[model samples]
Target: MLLVLSEQEKTSFTFLTSLPEQVYPDLVKTALSQLLSTKQITKVVNSAAAKLKVEVASLTNSSLYVLSQCLLNSAKRNLTPEDLTSSLKACGVEVTIVTPLVISYTENRDILIDIITRSTVQAPEYRSMEWRLECQVGSRSLHNTVIPNVLTKWKISDPRFNNLKTKETYLNCDVNTLQHITESLRAAQLELDTLHARKMCRNLARIG
Candidate 1:
């Protein structure tokens, strides 16, 4: 008989199939829960590390595993993952995660430490600073910014402002909600990247 699996079921089965089964249900459940959390940490670490623009492929898995534990610890301490340099030191990752070549690529632990520092997004200081948005249509330009705790009707400097449009920028959302919005943006970017890759593959096949 053939087995049918949904995408989620396939993913779960692939992960679990490699592990040894235990007789105790509670132990299995706890292990699976930790595994899921670790997976999430790996995802966050990898995305954050990409901001460093380094060839980190060699230490990718090891670095993610070590960094994920620090991330979890940061949550317990109510600290930002942006405290990455200290967290890496606390985790003793500097000694284990890097080789001579990895060190040379990053030029030292200070640069490697930047992987987390650059990746983690801190709460926006909208009160002290506003984010700018600029647009141009046929040489007509428009510019505006979102200010914190301000609900004033902001007008663009250029006449083209009326023609240009943008999705609702969640200026009113709390910092936590803003972080969720960033995560959603990352997911959307990944989806677009996958779509573009598939389109390129199809075009290449046609050209061949």
Candidate 2:
């Protein structure tokens, strides 16, 4: 796929090509490492500029950020080196600059992919549900009344936390409300099974 670039990104990337050719490998390596790191992009760009004895603006922190994102996405999607080269060329990056970047990516693709897979955060998922029915025969204010209600507890697990935390939610509703909730949930399940909804989910997964 051809990688589309924003106007600002296109302008910023031009600054990348102007850097010394000898620095390409180190630059690409630094950019890739920074992508999987918590460090700020400015520090990386500024540090590179200092080492190269060039102005910080000349290094273009925005370009480095975009480069890192491109590398990360490409790795996540398992794009081939040839595919990455073409995509970068389509975006107007010089062959010289693309060469080292693509080389570094190819050499480290498996490692990057492993890191990404390990770092991925899964959305919370339903683990289990418990429900109970209760009948209230009478209360102090209403001596001769009956009320039926449902008490539900839902457990959800999130993989993002180190502990693999599970959250519990309690819900109380009358019979009528419980029926409505059941019907709504059934409708949602049917919607998810539809072709259109499935396709939309696939697209969202690819984007993510």
| Highest lDDT against the true fold, candidate | 2
TM-score result, candidate 2: 0.58
List, residue by residue over 1-208, the lDDT tens digit for candidate 1.
1112234433433333232333122222222234343343444334434544433452243333323333333333344323434443343333332122122323333433454445555432222224443323233353463333322223333222332432223244444565687899999778767978789877664322
Clashes of each: 0, 0
**Cα lDDT for residue 125, model 1?**
24
RMSD of each: 20.6, 6.1
Residue-level lDDT tens digits of model 2 in 118-175: 7877778888999998999999999889899989899988566733899889999998
| Cα lDDT, model 2, residue 176 | 92
List ranges where model 2 is wrong by over 4 Å: 1-3, 33-53, 76-83, 117-123, 127-133, 139-141, 153-208
Instruction: Give each model a TM-score.
Output: 0.18, 0.58
- Show where candidate 1 strays beyond 4 Å: 1-170, 195-208
Model 1 residue pairs with clashes: none
